[model samples]
Target: MSRPRKAEDPIRLPVPCNRCGQHHQTVARWPDGGVCGYCYQQAKRTRGICAFGHEGVLPGIIDEQPTCRRCSGIRLNVDCVSCGAEDELDSGGRCWTCALGNVVDDLLTDPATGAIAKDLIPLGATLKSMKRANSGMTWIRQKHVTAFLRNLAVAPKITHEIFDQLPDSRTREYVRGLLTEHGVLPQRDELRMRYNNWAA
Candidate 1:
């Protein structure tokens, strides 16, 4: 009373089922799935969840020392220039308000006068010598001094200048002082002096 089954209608292949000892035939590879399906689902779920158990993939790397995006001082190691307090920078590194402190300091303590002295002293020495030769007016002639000061006020600022007639001791000492500030000259007393002695 039943129709004959075709050979390939549901091609049967025997596979062991975890739930039972007997093998079963099915169209799909897991047709009689039981404990095997549970195992597969469990594996899928475990793979999807990260170690933190959040439903997603875990990050490959984590940032250990993340600073504030705005200030870059999550730990607050940097000093704030504005309030002179140790605080995070608004934009990391030096804060905006404290950045111009250097310019302000320069304006207040500018070395323009010192620079002029260095430039004028050396060349002015020659002029002083010529004036002395022509007019016999000795010792830092008044006109030359005024001209030297005015010239120094403008450009090529220097630290110290040496005059030809005067002993070079003062110029050498000034230069030594400058060098000392930079921690370059180790010993000031040991420095050799060169001067044009008037009597010599």
Candidate 2:
């Protein structure tokens, strides 16, 4: 016996173009609206009118108004170089706060201490001027004193030995005072207690 034939699906009819009012075989509706292929191509090549009445390719949209590239340039945000903070860039490409803070930090951390040395030491003190002062009591600048103190604080060398090696008696006294005040050097009583504990 022959089997019954299945019903075929109906063909889709072409829709009329909204812009050209002509029926197109491949006309498709867009989310914003519908337009014929020819009309869409013409619109793509045409420059849009901005709110300022300037005719150009729109690069940005602000407050529902299209803006040309030149008009959009004013909205760009410049960031600081050092901190990445967003603001109008200064001549140095840094924000005011970051620029000031960086300048202060550089002044305090500069390796060349000769220029800043006088500010760190007592007035009228005679020391041999050298990049780094060692035995024989050569004059050293404030940067050298700062570097020595920082090294002593972080280095594993014995504190007394390092202190004795300082070129100037006055500088050594100053470093010792600072280390003592900061508790970097243990007190004699504290050392004696630690020894007693170890012995026990």
Candidate 3:
């Protein structure tokens, strides 16, 4: 006898993926366990001689032996049209990471000048280079976050005081911290300020 599981239990995501062991949203569940997008791509891209004479894209595992998808009767394919990379396609037949990159560019690009503000280039690059893109991707997906970034792209003044005047929230603080890191905003080092005050 076993207790019945609840129907409405909240499903927490970003758990350790069974394959890559990185925290991400579980995309596919195999006999082994849940797999993330990256791990899923890796598994699909696994290449070598199978137990049989087959070679290329060995994605089937049977009785401790890797086999071709056809041989093992596994049917799965996710290919990105833009980059021709075998990955988990998210939109317009492009991989999620690729989509995330495009989104970052669009959000950071200044409408007035049709280019990223010179000061914000580093922030755009940092967001693009993130190892796991979902966190920033998830953030920017929000209507408010998208609006904030778009507004930031056109702001003439990039200063601490200007930022302080905005309505405060976690998203605003996070962007401010990033700006400080890239020298777009002045660092808030109280000890250094105190030392300078004493010297003066």
Most TM-score-accurate candidate: 3
Model 2: per-residue Cα lDDT over 77-184, one tens digit each: 345787785433444786544544443333333254423333223211222222222221222225666456444433334365566565544666655554555555
Per-residue C-alpha lDDT of model 1 across residues 14-126, encoded as one tens digit per residue: 45433333344332232224223333222222213333433322211124221221222112234555655432234445432343332223222326543333333444333
Order of candidate numbers by TM-score, starting with the best: 3, 2, 1
| Root-mean-square deviation per candidate | 32.2, 25.1, 9.0
Candidate no. 2 TM-score:
0.23
Candidate 3 lDDT score at position 70: 73
The lDDT of each candidate is: 0.33, 0.44, 0.73
**Candidate 3's residue-wise lDDT over 104-183, tens digit each?**
99999887889998888888888877765555677789988888888788788787666666666677878888888888
Residue pairs clashing, model 2: 117-142, 127-139, 128-139
Which candidate number maximizes lDDT? 3
Question: Which parts of model 1 are misplaced by more than 4 Å?
Answer: 1-157, 161-190, 193-200
TM-score preference between candidates 1 and 2, better one: 2
Compare candidates 1 and 3 on TM-score and give the better one: 3
Candidate that beats the other on TM-score, 2 or 3, i.e. the better one: 3
